[model samples]
Target: MSTYGSRGDVEPMAALAVTLQELGVEAVVCAPPEDEFRALLERAGVEMVAAGMAVKELIAEAKANPHITLPERARKVTSRQYEAVLEVAQKADVIIGSGLMPAAAGARTVADQLGLPFHLVAFQPVTMPSPYQPPVAYPGRPLPPDVTDNRELWKHDAESMNVIFGAAVNDHRVSVGLPPVPSIRAYVLNKRPWLAVDPVLSPWRPSDLLDVLQTGAWILPDTRPLPAELEAFLEADQEPVYVGFGSMAMGNAPAEVARAAVEAARKQGRRLVMAKGWAGLEAIDEADDCFVVGDVNQQKLFPRVAAVVHHGGAGTTTAAARAGTPQVIVPQVVDQPHFARRVAELGIGVAHEGSVPTSESLAEALNRALGMTRRAQEMAGQIKTDGTLVAARELGVA
Candidate 1:
């Protein structure tokens, strides 16, 4: 299988690949050549195919212009990824995409050519193409027709959808002699579709979707040790608000954002644990209430926090949800806004309005998240109960 995105995008697929293997299926993940990610998957004994471009470069380009990044770099890299995975999937009975991957798309193309069955896996509600009506955030923009409640966003029609596929991706596939497939109605997992993901699932709405099959986030068994700084922070405070912006902080003025986040932490009287990867916190003086750490087990850390504040990456969003902790989504770009809207619409948290945010906005959103009502907690719990075991059954592995 292939996953095409930044670290947030690749890690979930790695975890899912592990899960799939646990069910006695051998799997491999197509990832960028990042040593950190590459090493982890290597340690897991999963085959890793290195894509041509670095994820860092792709992220930089995307941050510069999110409007076309998905179609350009994401789609192009993914198309080339297929050549690497074909050696394995051709001999296998089934193929799956962690989300959208060039390999997955390529694999899908090969599947149609060879008449094989392929499944597309989603980690976010917006990606699932489910049938549940998403709450209206922007009035008159009342959600697209492609989103639904379904857990799996399988491609029903490959023809028309293929045309809407990015030109870069299309050219790559055609160069490889792959026939164009028509676009199928993609199930929108979350109603918001503006985020960074496959665009073939556009023009969708709640009515145009199906009910969610899998309801909860996939839970991975944690066994890694925490870095000393992270451990120290955990020991210093029983629970703190987790804060970090994944790859989103690379190009932005991270220090300013970090300072604002730190200030907000102080006002709320909550301990702060920023992901060590947080870009701009080096200039800030560390207080007893603040700590910076590397390699947090998000599944483990998020639940223990009083709240979470971060760029609204899909994986982080789900991690916060799984922890049953309210979140303050300070989206930087792309799908961040889309996910932030979902966080607010679900009443799971508040969104910091506008592309740029201030400490006050961050604090307010944090306050609202920490003040989640019983209804919001219950809804979060419902999603927590999602069973991928049933998904295993559907794959005929359970």
Candidate 2:
């Protein structure tokens, strides 16, 4: 398995690797070489072959140089994958690609070179093209305002993909002695792509464009106990509202976002547990009513919380849902909006109107979320925890 992106993208692959190993298959992951990623795979007893640049460095560079085109960045990442994935592909019976588009493209070409079957998996349904939904617009390339038809928007989407990744992919293919692909979009996604999302949270509607295999969300079973401080806080009073933006650098003002979350939870007469994630959020002030933590296990903590206010990444959203915790989804970008909408549609949470949340907006959303606790609890029973086992069986590992 090979992937590159945030924790949301890499952690699922680690979960799948662990499942495959339990089924007597030797699983190795080629992913970004960040310490957190290495620790995650290490805990699963899986081998990690570093691929691509460090994700934090990539994000920082992108922010530093706003003028760098998407195509240029894609080319650099694709080149790195070609160099790193060759050794792993040589030993694997099959290749699986996920996360960023450029990384997947390079892995597919490596599979082509070695005559290995390549499968592309999406953690969310939004990335997969369909007539039921339009494609995610590329940065700096918005869809035409006049184009209302989904099909038309998808056509435009295809063109934009080719414009961004076609050359980078085709150039690598030709260098590897493989024929150049005509359409980068079709080349990567036309095969029966697998969608690794919970059917209840993000359902897939069939389309003519691609054959999709909808599997439940791949989850890493975390057994780590919460810290003593957090445990004491939970026992002291009413359940606190939990707020964290896992892996997201919460825009330019993370401190502002943290303050708003703290204020909102206070208005509802609830204590607050804030996670200082990649955004490095801190408690606005030192008080017994609020506790700040880092990289704790949500699986153990979410059930104790009154509500979850978060940037709606796939894994976090699914974790909170499985714990039967109501949510307030403040979506930032990419597939986050899709998850936000689904949470609202299920009546388990409120999708904040926009990304930047003030105290008033968060309090309002939290009020709505707290009222739907019963629905959330009922829905939790319907969430499947066997998604990793299912994926392993599908891969013929079990």
Candidate 3:
């Protein structure tokens, strides 16, 4: 299957592939060739291939090739990525994939040509129209008070995506020798939709259009031992609060965030573990109790921490949930803010209002999260089931 993005995007696919293997089907994840999560996939013994462009390079290409609109580049990228996975999937009996522009662009059309089953996957309710909540991708800010509880507006979320991206999506169809889809609904509704998230997070809301089967989160846990230094830190007298924003570049913002995190740590009188993410947050100075390190497995670390602080990516959110730790959600992009909202709604964490995390805001959220430990722990127990294996059962992989 093809998948891409940072740890949040690719790691889930790796976990699913591992689960398929456990069900007696050989599976490989085609993902961005990044070492952070790739190392975890490797440790899990799941096969990962470089598919499409790397996240860092994709960003660079967008900046360097500004003449090409992002949507257009997305189309071109997906077109280029079409055959790489199809070449592998067509050989197999079934095709399952998610993540990134290219994989979503052409996988289904190619699978349709071969008359093979293409199981579509989703990490969140961002795409699906739901009665329970607004579309995670809804463009408008602060809902008008009247539409607050109305689930009908949520359906338009998918419609808006189709309206914006329909032509680009059809370009993929024409290239793949498939008929153009009339709408986003036509494009996506043809497949058996598999939602690879915890049912607790994406519980089935009433909907005629979305017959989504919720599998508990597809968690391919990292199996490696933590670095000796990190392990020692965990064993220390004071439990540290964790901080890391995966892959979201913080530009000139890191120093402030670092300062905030340090001050926040000081205010709480707690130790800290700060991950210098993609150079997002650098260590400005040595703090007595804080340890700044590179990407490490959250699966192994969150359990030992007092709380998790990050840019609320699905993987990080799920990891912290499973670890039973409260969270400070400093979301930076799409789907992240949605997860952050869920964190607050479920009483497990705090979701900041905007993108870019400020230290003061993070500290406020962290304090709130610390107070919600009981709720967070309760959620941890509820979402711990393996969604990957459940997905295999649903798709009849066995």
Candidate 4:
């Protein structure tokens, strides 16, 4: 198994590895060395072969060079990352991967070489060829509804991805002695596709390929006890509002988000637990009602929070929902806005316009979430936390 990206991506891959291991399937997770959950995977008894690239550094590069096109981004992934995946693939029976660029592309080549089946798991719904949803694009916005089977749009989307990453993928193929591919559509075709989400939060897209499977939400198995100070703070009064933008670089968004978080807490009369994620929130420093922290298990903290304010990554969204907390998502990219919409549609939360939001807007969102606490709790109760096991069973690994 291999994947790339932030905690949101790695954690689910690790969870799946754990499930596979429990089912007697030996699994090793491969990804760029900087994954936050490398330790989590190792601690959970899943072996990790570090892909040499630093995922955070790669993301920083991508963010810094916004002019970089998708194909360039795809081709730009360090050869070391692909090498690590190839090395690990040599010993595997089935190649399972997550993420679009390196993982799926690399796994496709490896699987073809070894005559092994390649399976994909992802938080993004459009990763598969979907007949129900419009092709995915950057930033959050509505798209024209699918009037019929979305295969053509899906093909267009796949070709666009090929344009972005195909050059680099072909280069790797050359190094691995595999023939270059003309299109990337093969990566999504006739493959085992798993959408790692909870249906209650993200309903199945009707346009998804008939073969696509739902793996449910994959959260870290460990929920470490909160620090004593955090424990005491939670007991202090009404639950605090949680403000975090997981894996998104701050790049000047921190101060704005911090002010909004503080102001929202003040307006709503709640304490704040602000996670200083990739976005290092500066205004969080001087706020008396706010407690700033680095990454901690949201699975443990969410149950105590009054509401969740986030960038709407899949892992965080599921964790918040299962904790029975209402979420206020200010989405920034693919699949995030989709999750935000589902939160609102389910009557459990609200979604902001985009990533940039003001204190007034945040306060309103928090207030809206606060009003639906009971509904959020009900949604939480209905979520199947055992999705990982279900996925393993479906794979027939056990």
Candidate 5:
């Protein structure tokens, strides 16, 4: 298994790895060489092979080098994957690729070279092209305003993918003595790519473009106990609103976002449990009602919260749903908006209009979310928790 991105990307792969191990299959994961990722796989008792630069380093480099185009950066990252994943994949019976397209492209090429069966896995349904939904627009490339048809949008999406990764991928493929692929999108997605998402949360519509395997969201059972401080805080409060943007940079003003969340919770007459994630969000003041936590067990904490205010990552959204907690989804980028829309469609949460939210916006969303508590609880029982098990069985490793 190979993946690259934030905790959201790495965590699910780790979960699947753990399940595979239990089924008597020795699993090794190739991912970004970040301390947190290493620790996660270590805890799961799975071997980890560092795939490329750490996610932070990659993001920082992209920011620092403004002259470098997205395509060029993607080329560099994909090239690095060849160096890292090739050796590990040589010993594997099959190759599974996930995370960013460029990284997956590199791993796929290695699989091609080794004559291994390669499978691409998407965490959300939006990543896969379909007539039911349009593809996500590229960073600087927006879809034409006049184009309302999903098929046209997907066609443009394919063109954009080719523009960004076609040369980068084909160049490496040529270097490794493989034939150049005509469509980078098709090559990466393959004929039957797996969708690792909870069907209740994000359903995959059958498409003529590809045969998608919809597995329930890969969830590792988190046994780590919540910190005593957080436990006491939860005990003392009347179901405080839990606010956290897992792995999202939270834009240029993380502190402002944190303050807005705190103020919003206060307006609702509720306590706040803030997670200081990768953006390093901090409390504005040492208020007793606002408790700040770091790297705590969200699985154990979400059930006790009034509502979850989050960035709408696939994993976090699923966790909140499984906990039977209502949500306010303030999406950031990529598949986040899709998850936000799903939450609202399910009547389990409110999707904030934009990425950045002021106190008023957050409070309003929070109010709506709190009102949907009954619906959220009703949906909780429907979410499947056996995604990893199902995926392992599908692999026929046991």
Candidate 6:
């Protein structure tokens, strides 16, 4: 019930929590403090527990000094929540860990303590059908298994396969005050110890886990319809390209990013719609062809766009995919590159090199995405059909 991270990390859980509430299931979402985030959840009619750290501080530090920032502190808080859960795990029938951070890991500890079943959840496939040394407990469905063994699963090369993540289970045991066990392989979910979580929301094989969970996109209360300015922006223009860096992108020089996007759009003769994210782009004056608006729902927004340019967060990737819009990702760091690779591999989009992407490079990628052939369009359609509700159903919470 407790989770912590940036708004992107916490928002999805908030969405899921709200969806659970609509089904008469009450769930509390926890995260580092951010008033905007609390507002989002509050509008969804979901209860949020703030961890008292300013999310803006975390964003600033992540860009300035990623090695020491909120994620580490968030981990500490999440790990600490286990003491609270330990007291209640016995009364709870099921515990689910949505991410691999302290909260999810802590959930696993308390689950085992109370002998409750737990499932690991993943929003991406990188952690699944794992590539590193295979977890003996759960030998995953090897990627292109015909081409390699379980060891060769993660590393596209054999030499890399020889290297392993080492005995992380022991580390987890130590972190949670549990006895060191054997070099236990992956957890029950992915079968790779390093990729373990409480309950994985695996959609490829609905019955792969105990229950299939659905993706609960954030549900903002029905407010006044898009303001006239935004409505005119969406209606007057041809589907513009969407340029947004969700919760993670706030740390970036967003105005610069938005300006770069403007230059790219001008080159392509397309409009640019920027998501009102943590990235500080709100001050950019809106022109007839360009708009800076707050919180246009991604599920509703991406489809109207010709292409999406983003930082390659998994949730954003999914949103663009659902819209059947090809994506052009400019990955800054972290799991972004991984998601970027998946986009290229799946023909869903292209990944740019970094934060300093040139307008020409971005424009070219946008053209490539906008020019998706009929077959590619069909493929995108297939992906879109993996609806949020389907994700919920798979999780057994629908």
Q: Which structure among the candidates has the greatest lDDT?
A: 5
**Pairs with backbone N, CA or C atoms under 3 Å apart (clashes), candidate 3:** 78-102
Candidate 5 vs candidate 6: which has greater TM-score?
A: 5
For candidate 6, give the lDDT.
Answer: 0.58
| Each candidate: RMSD | 6.6, 1.0, 2.8, 2.9, 1.0, 6.8
Per-candidate TM-scores read 0.75, 0.98, 0.90, 0.91, 0.98, 0.71
For each of the candidates, give the backbone clash count: 41, 0, 1, 5, 0, 23
Q: Candidate 4's residue-wise lDDT over 1-398, tens digit each?
A: 87777777788888888878777788888866864666677678788888656777776687789998666666655355566777877767887777656556766777777878787777766555666666674332223365344676665666666666677888878887888877765554445577778877876765435576786787657757888888888888888998989888745667887888888888988889888888887545565678888767788899999899998888888888899999899998778888888899999889997688888988888888899999998888888788788778777865
Better candidate number, 1 or 3, judged by lDDT: 3
lDDT of each: 0.61, 0.90, 0.74, 0.76, 0.91, 0.58
* lDDT tens readout by residue for model 3, 1-398: 77666767777787888878877888877777776657767877887766766778888887787787645765755665566677677577776767753456566666777887777787876666666656554333333556665465654555665655566777778766888877755455454577777777656665765677777788876766789988888887678999888877865577787888877876787888999887467666765588888867778899889989888777788889989999988887777878888888899999876666556776777787899989988888888567887888777874
Question: For residues 323-349, could you state the per-residue lDDT of candidate 5 as single tens digits?
Answer: 999999999998899999999999999
Candidate 5 regions off by >4 Å?
A: none
Model 3: how far residue 213 lies from native, Å: 0.8
lDDT score at residue 394, model 3, on the 0-100 scale:
76
lDDT of candidate 1 over 1-398, digit per residue (tens): 66666667676566656677888877777667777678668766677877556766766676677667344554665556666556556677765554444445665655554566666655554534334423322212333367553332233222223434545555665777775433423311222222222121122344454543442344445566677667777777567887887766534667777777888887888888887563544427846777777665776677668888878877677667666788888776555777787778778778887645567888887887889835355655555422344456666876
Candidate 5, 360: how far from true, in Å?
A: 1.0
Candidate 6 lDDT, 1-398, residue by residue in tens: 54556655666666566666766666665555678777777777776665435657755556677565343544454455565556545556666555434455556666776777765555544434433333222122224646546444433322222212113333555776677543222332423112211121123333222233334333222344556777677888577888888765534466677777888887889988877676656535646667877666677677678888888776677667766778888886556777677677777788786666667777787778777634345555454332334435545667
Best-to-worst order by lDDT is 5, 2, 4, 3, 1, 6
